[model samples]
Target: MKKHLTFLILLILTAATGYGQSATSDADSKIVTFRFQPGKDMFVLKGNETELTRLYSLVDEYHGRITAGELPIRVDGYCASRATEKANLHTAYLRANRVKSELITQKGLKEGDFVTANYATAYNGDKDVVVVTLRIPVKKETAVVKEEPKTETRTETKPEPQPTVKEQPAAPVTEPVTETVPETPAPVRPYHFAVRTNVLYDAMLLPTLGVEWRINTDLGVKLDGSLAWWGGEHGKTMKVWLLNPEVRWYLLHDKRFYAGVSGSYGEYNIYKYMVGNILSKDTGYQGSLWSAGLTVGYQLYLSRSFSVDFNLGLGYVRSEYDSFGMTNGVRVYKDRDKTKNFWGPTQVGINLIWTIGGHK
Candidate 1:
């Protein structure tokens, strides 16, 4: 019985020692945590003493020691459980890369200092947090500045008048005023939603608005709506409304270039065509138009919040209209239900897009 009790006591002691060592190690370092919003890669750092801010302060304080030798930094990223495992994993990867980018580009830390892991699937804690564990303590240096310098500065007297030994101070020994240039911030990645307007329609007095929703990394849907309802001088009437919906696939690695399949429907009444900003003739047509097309476009991200797109489409177009002509300032309908079919140039647009939500 005594032998068994002794073994149990030794086992307890060993367990306790192991836990104590872990506690001490954890106590020696601080674990800072930064949180992300849903579908965002950037962390929140606005509040007082936020984890991200604290991490920056810590890095700033220990920068000298960090650059002198190897500084171990571990960044673990996570996402919420709302998305699929693959989506969560992708978000986690972006979050970790974002932190590493800011640390290297903004804070002047070296990339080799980072040890990164994405734990969106494995993490069970706060789903929106990225935990940063720095292996060094805040007090990387023990010598306090006040302990050795204030009294010595007080004891030193002003310099006595000295004779000039040379005619000029040599340029080599007296270093030039070398200003440290700041590093440029990394470009923001586009994501989520966007609003756009087509200039081609606007020139014809038809105001248009388009909305795009990014469903995933590569696929998206866009809808464009246009309206022009106005009466002109000399009985020239222009009234139309159009809706175009498209599904797009971003094939390029930059996510700027895309291909889309589009369908359109419109109702229009044109007494005179609005071409070259002029109403041309007295002949008019009232029509319902339908089109199905394949569009190919390339997008250029001009800024974080804006992009320019150029696209052209070719497909089948069918229009059913009633031909009419004005007689002595009176309407005269000559024929009805005249149908026309065209197989080319269904869509053309130069769109200016504004991105919404946070950059992904």
Candidate 2:
């Protein structure tokens, strides 16, 4: 009985050793990770494009190995805990799938070659991230070694006593752990072209329209036109059309303050004018005028695509006109080809601006 028990014990020990030696080796993996802002599926271009491009380059480098099942790729998506579970899941899904699609479509990799997961915890427990990992697995062949059987003796063994470790008191923290935040790139804005009309002109039954071409981020060119045409009725008649063009230099990043120079030209006709005088003759003036000025403006944004612009100009004006006076309900010229030059406030506008096109 004792001999049989010894043989069983040795057989069990040998089997256990062989089983432990039968192994699959896994190599360390390389990873590329990019993070998103809260409630955002896409990472900011300025921050994550480098890592994403690198990941694509790596995919290209490992294309053959990956297709042959030698190097496997895995993509995992995670979201910040700021939204409901369903929303988060959807965002994570988009993030993962978009990246995979880029690899498949742009890099010419097969979709089936990747193992993709959505809404997973990222490395270091980051809440919002997409991680791509590449791993190489090594398979080892089994080798059998034969040895002569040796005699063995069983001895009673006792476990070594684990040394008692004294718990160290944690040091008091002096400063709060502050997370470093990446600088946000400006979102899409009005790239070019803005249309506008003046509220005061509309109120006065005058038609005013303005167009702006944003030359660049800090500069713009604007053209404005207005008309106040009224039919001749009794002693009152007025007709006018004005064209103004300006170039602006925006002083604020939000396009709030702008200072620039502008030029204006107009033709005007008015019949009969009096300062509440019964004896004063009703006189009329018809002329063409031109003005140039320095303009300063303030813009208040109502939405991403709308703003209110208030601008004022101070400048010089020159005009040529023919003066007419009413005589027995007939027109009589008092002065002809008269020229006048003046300097004062030339333009004022309270404009409603609609920025055209999509955000940048």
Candidate 3:
């Protein structure tokens, strides 16, 4: 009976230890979002000494749990909305990667045991912040134990010299205990398509249209076109057509800064301009210009779907022109065909953009 009591006590203690560990793990699994400096990559922990301490402690505990249980952990990284979508996505990945690096290098965590994901601005709405979370897999098992019932054997003095009948075999012990662990839910998908428009074209008085296809978080392509036509008395007329296409690359995590290469073809005819600053009465120049250049730009996002883009392009322009003499808007003669070349600013624009087809 004493042995049974001791065994019961040991079992109770073991169960209590397991429960305590489970509770500790739960406490350490909180979702933590850390702040960073605006437009910078450094974490901001000032006045958060307690939180910082707790964060490190939680990481250590997580590492210990995984090591002890040999269980896998999933660590998800997230960043809040920033100046650009690309920056947000990249920043989130970097933040999560940084944490993973620390755990592996400082806490002796195995890299393969962790799954890291970047949720970009989808998880957090705050600016310049990063969130990290840990998840453990659930497992179920069963254990069977047989407990012998306490028996007080009484000695019979009746010299029953007959072969002592062996005590009836103890009833077959059969007990099954089952334990099940809760399962973790799967993560949400993060990738999507987005379309954007540049409003600056409308303000130019020359109606323009643009389409942008964002290939991913770091790269995108845009195609734009602008057109204008005007006519007045004395054979004066002006017409312009421009087609511009560019490919952009986001260089920073916040995606506020970008560089692009653009190619443009422009055709114009200005019968309104004559020699010596006079209004054209019969002569004008018709020309086509082709330019290829590089541009650097910046974007400031006002909201999840709205932003302003500023771009400037500098490159070489090759222009070919022919002089046409017109009489009352009728071409009568042509002369002075020539070609001119120069290297300078080719484009300047400020655009208000609306992003569509992407998650808010």
- List, residue by residue over 151-180, the lDDT tens digit for candidate 3: 445567776643433444467666785754
> In candidate 1, where is summed lDDT lowest over 10 consecutive residues?
147-156
Give candidate 3 misplaced runs (Cα > 4 Å). Answer: 1-201, 271-284, 323-335
Candidate 2 — number of clashing residue pairs?
2
Between which residue pairs do clashes occur in model 1? none
Candidate 2 pairs with clashing backbones: 188-360, 189-360
Specify the highest-lDDT model's number.
1
Which stretches in model 2 have alpha-carbon errors above 4 Å? Answer: 1-191, 272-281, 358-360
Question: How much lDDT does each candidate structure score?
Answer: 0.75, 0.74, 0.65
Cα lDDT of model 2 by residue, 239-304, tens digit: 778899999998854456899999999997776422112224477788899999999999875554
**What's the residue-level lDDT of 147 in candidate 1?**
29
TM-score quality measure for candidate 3: 0.48
Give lDDT tens digits, candidate 1, residues 14-111: 99999997667643566887767777765444542466678877777666656566567888888865468778888888878767655663465666
Candidates sorted on TM-score, descending:
1, 3, 2
TM-score for all models, in order of appearance: 0.49, 0.47, 0.48
